[model samples]
Target: MSFNESVLGKEYLKYCNLKEIALNTKTLDLSNISWFFPTCLLPLGIFIKEHKEIHVIPPIDIEVAKYFNIIMKDKIDSVKRSYIPIVEILPNKKLIEKNLDSLISNKDYNMGSLNAFAYFIGELITNIYEHSKFSTAYIIAQRYNQKNFTEIGIIDNGISIPGSYEIKGFNFSDIKALEEAIQGLSTKYNDNEYSERGYGLRTSLNLLTEGFEAKCLIVSRGVGLIANKNNRFFYKMKEKDIFNGTLISTRFDNNIREVNVYAYIDT
Candidate 1:
């Protein structure tokens, strides 16, 4: 079957469906893809990298193919022995820290902002190991000079937010699960008890909006949340397709200077 999305709608059910089938099938065809959002590309790349049995047919759209190549270059190179790009496979904390240092050092970003970025990355990655049961994760970052913004993406294939909450005896739709998640709640804490254990996503989003005037998108299961300085919106997917994991993408301005790193950590 051919899969294509022109705008790559706010909901990610389509990609989720494709990922599920691709994981089970011997060879997954991808030659029909025409357009895709960065949100979809991140998880798709992770899926392709982890599953060795799946062979993908390159996208027909030239631009889409280029993006697939950029994000999946490291994985592709492993099999084809070609030049790889900047994508990093995050297997441990030391490598994550090292990659962030290299990325920050390459630019002239302010020290405070750099520190906050490091903190954010650490918190997000820690959450994966502490809460998410997935064994593999990927990190990709890009500094867009012309757009005056930098984007950092973390992708993991694991239990979704709703799945985690469900395990704790709480019932929430995917969208509601994300809403509660970013509010500093977690399945790790009992339903009746108040705890500060799962503040990673909330604190990170707060730092991005409050400290750096940035934006963020978090998707898991069939829902997604988008937050920026002006507004926050949530989308609940109607489609049956689902991505059984999480993707965190944040955008920060290149010239950001003042940031409240302590505030995020303390809160």
Candidate 2:
């Protein structure tokens, strides 16, 4: 009925079933999927990108359609400026700047620690283009006015953590690989200077969830690693039919204390 319920409730199974079918065939049917979480965007985009001839059916529900289009389509104007969409996964700061601009323009947000929020989002997105094989990616955001929380969702189409490790002469299950990644083990190393590549995911998770007491979710392949302040857990999902990229959802409460986002990535 509502957005969250439609996404996390029964429609989830429908989305999964559609995704499973799309894996074998070239058609992605979204007729049953009235909505989705940020976790779904990565696999959805990858499916479209991977199978060039794939047919995607937009949701029949008008409200859901609008939200879906806002995320999937790249349009910026007076009416739609509240959100910015990036269709290509490139190492471009301009995209990040656009996101920052959107956040500022949407006065509904309190924009606590704007600089830190900017860096937090920028670093995560940048990592996608730099590593992840850069196949395709998507970014979406939503503001919960009453709740005073802004959620940003980002995902990429590439070799997931487990797949990356497998390629590097090491094999680990999806859960194990996700744990390794969150623990700050990056398969990538910066070409110049000290290794600044690995800490982005871990640092952001710690700052946003631990420091600000926000909720976070990281989906890589078949598992979702979630953190809420001091507690961290996971959900096994999608199995072999999972997204090849990483998907992250960061929730920020407008009333939270300021954070020095840069200080978290000292490693």
Candidate 3:
């Protein structure tokens, strides 16, 4: 299959992804684009006054797609689709924790949610690090004031959900494989203890959505998790085969002020 077809799908779904967002939004009369390092404010002020949209998609491979999603979700009007690159996402706990500290800081998220966010990020990153071998990986985080929530997405261009299932010695043709992966029963690792004892994804799903409107999606495997919504883990692959990589996304309301991470501090 062609890269794009294998990567996304042959149908091209809707162009409302990241590529279009990056190019088109910049043309709008009210667009404000900013870059870090030097932190130029003059350009931001001019764009804000004259443009209709503002986006902050880092140059990193994975951030492109996530940046598009964040801007589109926050867009007040119509948004065009775009194609964004996926990056290598490592699973090291230290790297993951550092990323959380840098991206999802205290200024935006609350205490408990931040803690949960760190946990979820760590788990997802760990999964990516341990399972896939992609060269690029990134996590995109954005706050939605209208929805009173924050969305975080981790994308990688490694093994997909179905591929992950296949590696576990299960038959890919079996529809039950999807269910197994979604229910957290698949051979996530070669060792049973590592997969079973690993509470990253499981605990993340439980804590992030506890008594709140939270959702998680593993696009690499065509599986999704949603609480109090259309909560079902289904496959969305076009080919009868597996997926290109994975995208673990989660969203939670903004009711917390700080995160308690004593349990995971050592990790």
Q: Where does the lowest 10-residue lDDT sum fall in candidate 1?
A: 76-85
Q: Best candidate, lDDT-wise?
A: 1
Q: State the local distance difference test value for candidate 2.
A: 0.62
Give me the runs in candidate 3 sitting further than 4 Å from their true place: 1-97, 173-175, 186-194, 197-199, 221-230, 239-243, 256-267
Model 2: CA > 4 A from native: 1-14, 21-37, 52-54, 74-88, 91-112, 189-194, 235-241
Which residue pairs clash in candidate 2? none
**lDDT tens digits, residues 26-111, model 1?**
66667887765555667777777778678888888886677678776644221111111244646565656655555445435677
lDDT of 3 by residue, 1-267 (tens): 232332122112221132234345664222222221100111122223334455543434443333333333322211212111122244444644443555545455456765666566666776667666655556655455665665555666666656766786767643455455545663555544535524455555555554334655444544322332334444444443232566555555666445455443324
Question: Backbone clash tally for model 2?
Answer: 0
TM-score for each of the candidates? 0.74, 0.75, 0.56
Q: What is the C-alpha lDDT of each candidate?
A: 0.68, 0.62, 0.45
- Using TM-score, rank the candidates from best to worst: 2, 1, 3
- Candidate 2, 60: how far from true, in Å? 2.8
